[model samples]
Target chain A: MSEVTRPTLSDALTERMLELIRTGGHRPGDRLPSTRELSQRFAVTTPTLREALRRLEATGAIEMRHGSGIYVGADIERLVLPNPNMREIHAAQLLELLGARIVIEPPLAALAAEHAGGEELSALQRVLDEAGRHLRGEDAELHDANMTFHRATARMAGNSVLNEVVDSLLTVHGPEQREILQIFDDRRRDYEEHLAILEAIEARDAAQAESRMRAHLVDVKTVIEHRLQSPR
Target chain B: MSEVTRPTLSDALTERMLELIRTGGHRPGDRLPSTRELSQRFAVTTPTLREALRRLEATGAIEMRHGSGIYVGADIERLVLPNPNMREIHAAQLLELLGARIVIEPPLAALAAEHAGGEELSALQRVLDEAGRHLRGEDAELHDANMTFHRATARMAGNSVLNEVVDSLLTVHGPEQREILQIFDDRRRDYEEHLAILEAIEARDAAQAESRMRAHLVDVKTVIEHRLQSPR
Candidate 1:
């Protein structure tokens, strides 16, 4: 190992790299110098530079394509992120996650109703239609469609930070949510609830959209709670 | 450099490290085997191990003390985290952040009012008191106290996930928020608003607490918005 491989060296290099990005005004997808070039510029050996790059990559600060070069990551500017290291969530945490969605997503739905543009509304309709076709189809496709619907509505609320927060929650909720589709087992009702939310949004009925969202999430949580108490 | 210093090796090592942490049933702050032992166990060189360790450290999946060994990170299980690499916020992103808080925090304040126990309420009161003392003092201290007040109220709301979300927001909002304090420039009113929210929580008046919290954040956001329009 190089003498420069100490933790402090890596920490300093991370800070310097961030400074370089900021000073260079590199936006997401903008390329940074190559690893070899970066090491030469920073006067560090390749191992130390690689360690810093991995740290940046782990947190979505930067991207490192193997044969390609480095680029700023899309999530670098996001205020919130899903814990990338989360492998599994316990039952209690899963319910708490739903509770958070209950508190958060409803208001965003109301905002979506108030603010959604014509193009946005049609796109949202398309997402629901996709979900409808997959209602009886594979779990993964339906789950993706379902998640996209929630994400699109949150985006329509016109607050990127809230959108990031909701996206992070859904991303971390991924596996359990798929299992939720299996256990909640009312794929039709689930699809219908989502449709109701979409209709309310399309009609620009903010109150109706908000209440429907709350009801839908509460229903899902209630079913999950009951199932958890007596697992099949 | 070792032949194993490739990006794929680093990625594989990161996954293996996560597996080790999970399969070993380690909780936050639990000590893991030393780097030498971990290297021996995993059959990778020290440089590869260090790269993985740095990635984990950056994301708070693990902590590496300088001379001490590694411990599982407290944030490993959290569903949401502040983006650790956020260096600065643009004026627009900052406004959107406040808008997000306006949507999310009010409901939490109401929940805090409904669910806060005597001890938790007292603790929240103490946080505000700390803020009060620093009202005319250093900006950083007052900022810390105010943040603690918000975080404690979110915690008292009894949802860990929401608390994580709020904490993440506040964490990323740190530096810009201090600048906001100077711009908003009503230290006394800021302190007073926090007191009113705490009072409503203590009174267990959920409606009053929620509205007060909402109005307070709106007040701050309005001031910041105006200031951003015409900077000092």
Candidate 2:
């Protein structure tokens, strides 16, 4: 088991796989050659090929379905990604994540206010409406709805890279954010704050939207800080 | 080659490996069990264990030195990461990347101004001096120096997560950014704008630092946009 395999071969194989995808003009969801064909083509053993495939799978460059086949992953084109290996976040990291949101998301809300179109605004309204129903329901569903509102607002800002950044932040801290929902206590206030931000965006009031977003995140951060310090 | 190996086994093994690290309190750079030990502990074959290891290694959760044993990867705790498989970025993404920097980096400059200590400010000055030396020198060296300036400023802003975010953006765009250095073509102006930003940060003028950072990024974006539109 401690046999010295050439790690460089695995690396070069991964690069060649990427080159194959690029040269073939394969898009996400497109299928690639089966394992046998690929192994033969690359002249590597099954285990070696699997090593490269697993690497690509982990980073979301490709996906391997059990009985199905391999396809390019949806996240292959994304610039940033939530660390899939981040199973848990510490209290300090969670706060830093929120601090990041404090700096990045508010201006996105302002951009949302400035640029979101009619259909997009209506879509955002629908997301909040879903959250409204989940207000008294399962924490998981409510958490998801809340996350959706944040993601939707960021997307409506019309900058794909910023949207990716916010999405990645929200994703990696997801479990802790659910814990945050339980700790923060005032569910109604959370819902109302999101509504207020949405209203600002719908009203096309960029300044109001930006300030409201900042205030809302600051409120969450304040609560979390107090809770962390006083952990009853 | 497409033998029906249990994909579920690989997934579970990956989870267990992460658990092993967490339960053992293994920090980044700490060595993990060897391949032989891991195989015995997890009760899996070499191929199966290798798949799991490859996945973790791809995501920077672990490192597998060729002759040396396994070790915890330095990026194990990062919340966000640049896409390792991103071999090429399209022109549109390049512009959007610039747009994102314009939004995220300026406020960080202001924070750097407000919070950076004397030592940190001097370190930043040193980074700029390095860039000045490289301006008339190698493209790769100058590119590295310029990136260091951005990364150092982001770090000085004192938010680890934002620092990670900025670092990821820069990492994924390294090749294109080098190309940007050549196309933007005003090496002296690029160096001077960086100097002015450092001056503002050193002067503790948060507003000036913020505005200057924004203007500098906008200048780069303007040059890129003009070149893309005309491409002579």
Cα lDDT, all candidates: 0.93, 0.94
Instruction: State model 2's lDDT.
Output: 0.94
TM-score of each: 0.97, 0.98
DockQ of 2: 0.74
DockQ (C-alpha) of model 1?
0.61
Per-residue alpha-carbon lDDT of model 1 for B1-232, expressed as tens digits?
3322378888888899899999999999999888888889989988788888898998899998777778899999899999999988999999999999999999999999999999998888889889988988999999999999999999999999999999999999799999989998999999999999999999999999999999999999999999999987
- C-alpha lDDT (0 to 100) for residue A54 of candidate 2: 95
lDDT of 2 by residue, B23-91 (tens): 999999999998888889999988889999999999999999888889999999999999999999988
Q: Write the per-residue lDDT of candidate 1 for residues A1-232, one digit (tens) a residue.
A: 3322387888899999999999998999999988878999999988788889889999999988877788999989999999999988899999999999999999999999999999999999999999999988999999999999999999999999999999999999799899999999999999999999999999999999999999999999999999999998
Pairs in clash, predicted candidate 2: none
Model 2 chain A weakest lDDT span, ten residues long = A1-10
Instruction: Show the colliding residue pairs in model 1.
Output: none
